[model samples]
Target: MSVVHLHLPGFSFGDVPVLGPLTLTVDRGETLALTGPSGIGKSTLLRIVAGVYPARGTREIAGRMAFVFQEPTLLRWRTAQRNVEIAAKVSPDTALAALTEVGLGACADRFPDQLSLGQQRRLALARAFACDPDLMLLDEPFVSLDAAAAEEMMGLFADLRARRNMAGILVTHDAAEARRLATRTLTLSGRPATVTADVHAAA
Candidate 1:
């Protein structure tokens, strides 16, 4: 069965239209990349799917969801381990395991403020994975990282998905990133935004 089913005619902000006519289904273990230029409502669409944005649609999501924003969004005062514990609602051991998975084991007790940008993003990834989400909403999860770091994180994320069998919708402008991580790609266009292209990869 599909993990997510969305058929939205559209959405608006007051009198200004935001996005819509978005229809798609993401099955378990599938990753769909939502790609578009800046300000074209890609993030807005993800927000809708994550249930954070109210919109006109029939959305049927099958399981628990987690979101990874463009930025790390870690708690400044909290240690890396604490951030994961609070965000994922997991035990300390699980949090530390997740950190280890993301290659942040040695930094688990360090505060977010002490981590580099790349390390901070890795910590965020650890927290998200620790949630054990059935569905993931990723909005430019690799943005702002150096190419090497971004590539490494992408590999780690793919590994996590394989291990967990989760479905996801990722918003990114990088075509290479999309191709590397998603099982399918959806491109949005126009003012209010709609799916202009849908392409799937073979297994």
Candidate 2:
């Protein structure tokens, strides 16, 4: 099992305590759902761990890192398959295969503009999977999907998890997803964020 421990501090509030030296760990083959109020640094924590933030702390990330931002973050100008093709070591055939897994193979020739929001997110997921990442940083992955679509997307993630012993730190607002996907859960403080509660779910 892989464990991640993080410590971060912030000092921009009027009288709020430092954000952290927040510490948490997620084991391999498990998903950790991170939920908290707005502006509580949920995404910030993921970005910091993703190596996008230069804040003070030590992080231990195991294996390849793939990131799915709040938005699809796909190249609008590129075809669906082309986006994954450009970033990963996928050959043309493998890129198609990745898209197929996410049910986007028929839209292979289509660009980002032609797809629906759910489709866009699925494409983003395909691109991440194409890289064969060992860990994924998913920021609200099912934000735009409807209930049926959301369940399907969750299933897709489960399939991906099954393919490998990958772990995810998912930043989402949905408690259902937190309960459904995460083996562990953590809630942060409202103002000056600190890990207020840490919960381990029954798997």
Candidate 3:
């Protein structure tokens, strides 16, 4: 089953065109990675898919959706557990469970500023998981993490997606990350960005 379908006639920022006409779809449980040079509108495309950005296009997304931005984008005033609870609109018990799943249970009472970068990322994942989303849109989610931390987070994300059978769209510049996590990869290029490559990973 297809979880998302998007047909973008184009997108622009004022007079500057950012993306060209494009159409894309993601199947249930599939992970699609968008890769391209920096500032090529990869993240913009992601935002369009997430309905966070407006464009001249059609977008159909089935089931609940969650977004993990390049930064954690958490509420600074909220504790880790509260962040999940509020964002997911779930009970406290449910929130703690989500935190535990992401290895943030011990830090649940801590504020976002109190946690380490990796721990903050985990909390972000916990918030997303707590929402029980069937589709996840991530924009350079592991961008600033160190190698070990990035690897761990990737493993965690893989496990979560497998458990939930979720569809995902990941925007990143890292080819290895795309190869490891995406079932298919799309490369965007040019002044008015358009998909230039579509490669399916070997099963």
Cα lDDT tens digits for candidate 3, 68-112: 988999999999999999999999999999999988889889999
Candidate 2 has a TM-score of 0.91
Best by lDDT: 3
TM-score of model 3 (CA atoms): 0.98
lDDT of 1 by residue, 117-153 (tens): 9899889889988989989999998888889989988
Clashing pairs in 1: 9-21
lDDT of 2 by residue, 1-203 (tens): 67455656553334654366676666777778889887787887888788786666567877788888878888999999899899776898999999999999999999999999889988989999898887888999888778998998898987877797777899988998999888889998766677888899984
Would you give me the overall lDDT of model 3? 0.94
Measured with C-alpha atoms, the lDDT of residue 100 in candidate 3 is 92
TM-score of each: 0.96, 0.91, 0.98
Ranking by lDDT: 3, 1, 2
The 10-residue segment of model 1 with minimum total lDDT is 15-24
RMSD of each: 1.1, 2.2, 0.7
lDDT of each: 0.91, 0.83, 0.94
**Number of clashing pairs, model 3?**
0
The best-first sequence of candidates by TM-score reads 3, 1, 2
lDDT of 2 at 119: 92
